[model samples]
Target chain A: MISNPLFFVFIVVLIIWIGIALLLFRIDRKISLVEKEVSEALDEK
Target chain B: MFLYRLVYVLMPIGIFLSLLWVPPANILGDASRILYFHVPVAWVSFLAFLVAGLHSIALLIKKSEILYREAMAYNSAAIGMVFTVLTVITGSIWAKVSWGHFWNWDPRETSIVILMLIYIAYFSLFSALKSNPNRWGISSVYLIISMIIAPFLIFIVPRVYPSLHPDTIINQDKKIHLEASMRITLFFLVVTFTLLYGYIYKITNKLSLIIIKLRSSHDI
Candidate 1:
């Protein structure tokens, strides 16, 4: 079953999943930036 | 406790992967491999939504700070999205091999899409509340309404819709007949994903708490 052409499709989807995961990871990293900014603003007060 | 839970979840995944490398296959043959991923994602997504709905109920009952409720909503929404994406990927692969298409608009597939959209909307509502503290009530109301809609999306819609997904595994309409070994592997995978969901939830919840405190203090 893994030999079937559908397996190729799965491989493509797997790549896409990896890409999305990486993108989400980057977005989450930016969330930390936002948090830091919020902290700095609070400290100013 | 967290370390113990982590070990418990990982051991099964390790064993399952080892079994995959073995020559003689288990109960469901190659199809059983899908159990390692697909079932876990489906189970975890369901569990996340359940958590979200429960938290919504708690917020309504207790009327705690909007921050706590938002944390619950955000964590659930994030996990739900990840699991939903996983379900689509795994299910599509399974379908292509078994049903000869990437998609068939099957009842299960359609219902899952609908479920995914609902969560997407949930997340969007949360994002909208970020600029205005007063919007907390609106977000909470949305969460409550979404919770009310979840049961229908999860159960009723799938069953009622015409689907190519197998309705019966063997002689029974509900039970799938897999060898004991495959069943054990699948059980382990489900447990592993559930634990992973819990770990992620905790981390996200903490982040949300910190953000809330930061916001409140800054406003002062």
Candidate 2:
């Protein structure tokens, strides 16, 4: 329903920003997993 | 990490401010809005190249180098390539709407395309030699050479040749072209995007290190 083209851009950018945030969160979780596993291996050694 | 989270929250506000507050340029009209996103992405892409280049230099100097440092150099270039692609895409879209054509083969566009090719070649070269023991050294050298050419491609070529692209925001005289308020808006956007780039670059480098550790541990 938005007529102004700039508003469309605003919405699209918002969606893109959300998508980027989700990706960063998932990557952070993966980094945490790797950190834990490496520490555990060090402890065993 | 907290800083990273802050950028995630702040980028949206910057985007909205750019969209709602910044007035359009007299010549470029609404299409000028793309400048906020497109140019900032391009700047970050250049920053990524600089990081990779400096790391490549460090790799050459040390007799025994850190694996992740070398890997970080290459990985940052790859991430930079991603943003470079995004810049090209957004710029092309802006061009189409403003100029009524998709491909103009202007000096700036041509230079960016060449820059993209250089990054791709760096990626492909690394992939081709990744299994070899000399892979790091060889690829690092290639990145150095690419970095040498990059400044020419980015700064010199566009400026030397006549182009449809307007003079950069603050030109030689240091006089501002855009309105006073719009300058402030654009400046804030640039700052936010730079922070966005820093967050992404750090996270990506961390992830690459994680991947390296995983690979070594798995003995694959």
Candidate 2 chain B, poorest ten consecutive residues by summed lDDT: B62-71
Instruction: List, residue by residue over B1-220, the lDDT tens digit for candidate 2.
Output: 6765788777888888788778888877877888888888898888889889889988888836468878789778987898899889998998898888887999889999999998888888888886898888888888888889888888888888888888776468788777777777778777787787777777777777767776777784
Candidate 1: residue B121 lDDT (0-100): 84
Write candidate 1's Cα lDDT for B127-217 as tens digits.
Answer: 7767886665676677677767777776677667666765423333557665566566667767767766786676577578777777678
The per-model lDDT (C-alpha) reads: 0.69, 0.82
What total of clashing residue pairs does each candidate reach? 0, 0
Query: What are the per-model C-alpha RMSD values against the true structure?
Result: 5.7, 2.1
Give each prediction's DockQ, rounded to 2 decimals.
Answer: 0.12, 0.65
Least lDDT summed over 10 consecutive residues: which range in candidate 1 chain B? B18-27
> How does model 2 do on interface RMSD, in angstroms?
1.9
What TM-score does the A-chain of candidate 1 achieve? 0.71
Docking class of 2: medium
For model 1 chain A, where is the 10-residue window of minimal lDDT?
Answer: A5-14
| The candidate that achieves the highest TM-score relative to the unseen native structure | 2
lDDT of 1 by residue, A1-45 (tens): 677644554566456545644564565567667768777876777
Instruction: Specify the highest-lDDT model's number.
Output: 2
